[model samples]
Target: MPFVADALTATYKGIPPSFQWPVKFCFYNSLIAFVLGAATGNVSQVDRVWTFLPTIYAAYYALLPLWPSKSPLPLYPFVPETAHPDVIRNYSPRALLMFGLIFVWMCRLTFNTWRRGLFNLKDEDYRWEILRGKMPPWLFQMFNLVFIAFMQNVILFVIAVPVQIAAMQQPTGLGTSDCVLAVLALLDVAMEFVADNQQYAFQTFKHTGKKDEWPGAHIAWTKTDLKRGFITRGLWAWSRHPNFFCEQTFWVLINFFPLVAPEYPGYAPPLPLGAGTSLESLFPIIPGLVICSLFFSSTKFTESITAAKYPEYKSYQQRVSMFVPFLTPVWGLYLTLLGKKAEVDMVVYGQDVALDEKKKA
Candidate 1:
């Protein structure tokens, strides 16, 4: 415990010992995921538990008052670093609120994963399957170790670090910003829910021709929905991936919740300059920026596969924004002014894309 505290402050003075437990957990799980995924060649090991890890991290902070001294919970390892007596007796109301929101998020994602049958132990992400075919076994294993297993777990832990921020601060009453954040968070979840339902409906109807499924059935499906080979209706029509857009927005909103502690024990500077907690911090923006960059790169990779499979998807890509909602129309205009929007729109709207090519000849 003393070693952890020393190592945490070895480089910088104010790095919180609260990170000890989570840091250990990250190491253990990353090793397990890499080993299991490498042995099985099913690299979705992290995906199965992704929904719950943050909630676990969150529970540590939100319920810090309830935790036994020196650990998040009894029998669990934790930093022996001193905790604020005030926080120990009466916890942060804001952390509780943040935990509640993330709990809702975890539930929504878990249910969606269940409905998609991803909870099955053997299931892997479709993208991983593609990557396996493209890369050599040695290189892919390195990727699994570095990116899929370790880096992703670290990111997941970092994103939840904001909640840990909540624990270190002095307890306070809920403020107006909390109300605004709660409202916007709910709205963000709602839009993502609709986007998910629309995609589920399309996939279901495409296979079973069953429009009777509860949430997905809300939309009326037509021949066009079936013809395009990819969704271009509902929120999907608004942005190629409205759900992803909301996902990024939700975390950024979570990052903005009103707890400013540039001097807090847990605060870590994005760069190495200051010796103590006096360091100016960019901690809040790190989670949002990291995730947005991940989404951008992942979206590009995902679209590459989709574009190759469906000829019409290229037109959809040209017509729609990848993650921003209203910007789809703006991009469509860009295609239009280039004198190709009509043909592209026809393709995206489920008309014959080849007809324009034939006409050009």
Candidate 2:
């Protein structure tokens, strides 16, 4: 294991310093997480770095323009005179945009997690506890090392790779596609904000039993209030995990910046950069793909637990969409474009759940 870790470390160091430092930062953080998790049985060590690391990466990229080229710092190594003689070293507009957006996101996520008591480590994610219960101790330990500490940290860094890659290339200026990508990122953020607020409101209402007393989204689940179960309101009415969907979409949009950049050699979404001809260039897409896959698997596990807890979840799943909210509207449009009549399944519930007519009707 030490040999493998050494080999990985050496490989990381071989890259330019811009990539080298962030990769090493992620590696050390994950290693610390593994040690903490193994010793203390708290697998959420990775969670602590989740929101902050991306901001660091984004800030690294955003501040590239400020670093003097002739300086002895590691930032100078990113613009190897021989390799990137023509590369612009100015601060990237796209990167500045990305940095600002990520800062906002990091604050929101950190606040949300902190509010749930994650900052002091007083509370670990429920998913970790549930997995610990299901797996034997030894197996769970292995899972902790491989998945929680290693894989998750790696994935988190990968999702932020675009910011690093963009800074490395240092595209001349923001274009149409860059603006579009920025807007898309913010729109996803907005969606996630709405979804999270809805879920938070529902949970508060449920736990406090102050549905009518509270000044938020009304939770008039009289029939299921006695049962005490999942929420089916606001963004939840359209999709089971709207927040997860938005989260995935935002990262995927991050990957698009490279595609739209004027300096990118490739024509596709996952434009490779190192040497342009090697398979390593394709590595940029790994973060987005991995995140999408992770969310899919995560949703399945979360839904199972939720289903066992709530009797009506199955019916909700049968009626409303899962990842895509109000998929019927999109599907209906697709069918209409093909000159075929399609009836959207806009009805989610008969009486117990009431959906806003603006959703489809």
Candidate 3:
């Protein structure tokens, strides 16, 4: 692992400045995980599939030498030793609710990623291709292995620890709030899945067209004479990037579940005696909220990049909401604050709004 770490460092040194921050963030998170493992003398290879480091670290901490040496209760149905007796004894129902929500989130996201050919060894994301153009193969591979592959996965997993902690420490009982959260999570996953599928189908259709044939069968390709590659139908029509909106919504909903217990009506059933108070009572909601905020900021950055890429994007932005569909009135405030000028029948894809150049010319 030391040799692997050293190799990763060297590879990171060669990357362009723009990609370095996210890559370094991953490395830094992994380093912290390693240090924590070393300090607890529990250093051992954990399966890469369960890469969320916070839950792993929490479980590790729960089973540390300082605590009564026994397995923690399972946080998810699949994860072993996730919830120990000590944890369960102090469990908060609200936390467990969040845990369940996150489990669903992880499964959906992991499944989507797998289906998108992301799990295939032969293919990688296009963003990686862009990075490769600016760096050596070996160095890029090492950087990807450590930062993109290992560390990023670990950080996401670890950041989700609050769900596990909430489950372990919170009491358990069904409630209207839980039902509401479940519904929201389901909707979030569904929207993201649909958006991803649509985008995938559009790209595939574009690639398989005959040499002389016009691009069709996808909304983004409708104006075939125009060479705009932007997606603009289905959920994309509602929000230029619906998948991003759904992804952010999913995480926020997961984080919000713990807070719901306190807000739930008194008619909601209480947990068994000794199960403790609400999950938020045990662990503050602020950290998870802050993490959700960061995720939203990241989504904004992605949207900005997308807008810059597609000439038609600004016009689409004027007509559509960014994060919320059918919430045009709310987004109007944002446009006003930015002092954006609106133009009717603005063509987005073919040429710069300022220029009337034709494709051939």
The most accurate candidate by lDDT is 1
**Candidate 1: tens digits of C-alpha lDDT, residues 78-128:** 544365566567778888889999999888888888999999987889999
Query: Tens digits of per-residue lDDT for model 3 on 258-278?
Result: 556554332222221224456
Q: Which candidate is the best by TM-score?
A: 1
Q: What tens digits encode model 2's per-residue C-alpha lDDT throughout 1-361?
A: 5785587556843465455555655677778899998888788888887889778777766776454444375223233333243323566666777788788888878876766567777558888899899989999999988899988887877777777667666666778888888888887887787677667766666678655323334455544433536766666767778888898888888887876678775422223223454656567677789899999998899889988887667666665678897694564466567654222222234343334343536
Scored by CA lDDT, what does every candidate get?
A: 0.77, 0.69, 0.52
Superposition error at 165 for model 1 (Å): 1.7
By TM-score, how accurate is candidate 1? 0.86
Error of 3 at 265 (Å): 16
TM-score of 3: 0.56
Q: Summing lDDT over every window of 10 consecutive residues in candidate 3, give the lowest-scoring window.
A: 74-83
List RMSD in Å for every model shown.
5.5, 5.7, 12.0
Model 2 poorest 10 in a row by lDDT: 341-350
| Model 1 error, position 67 (Å) | 1.9
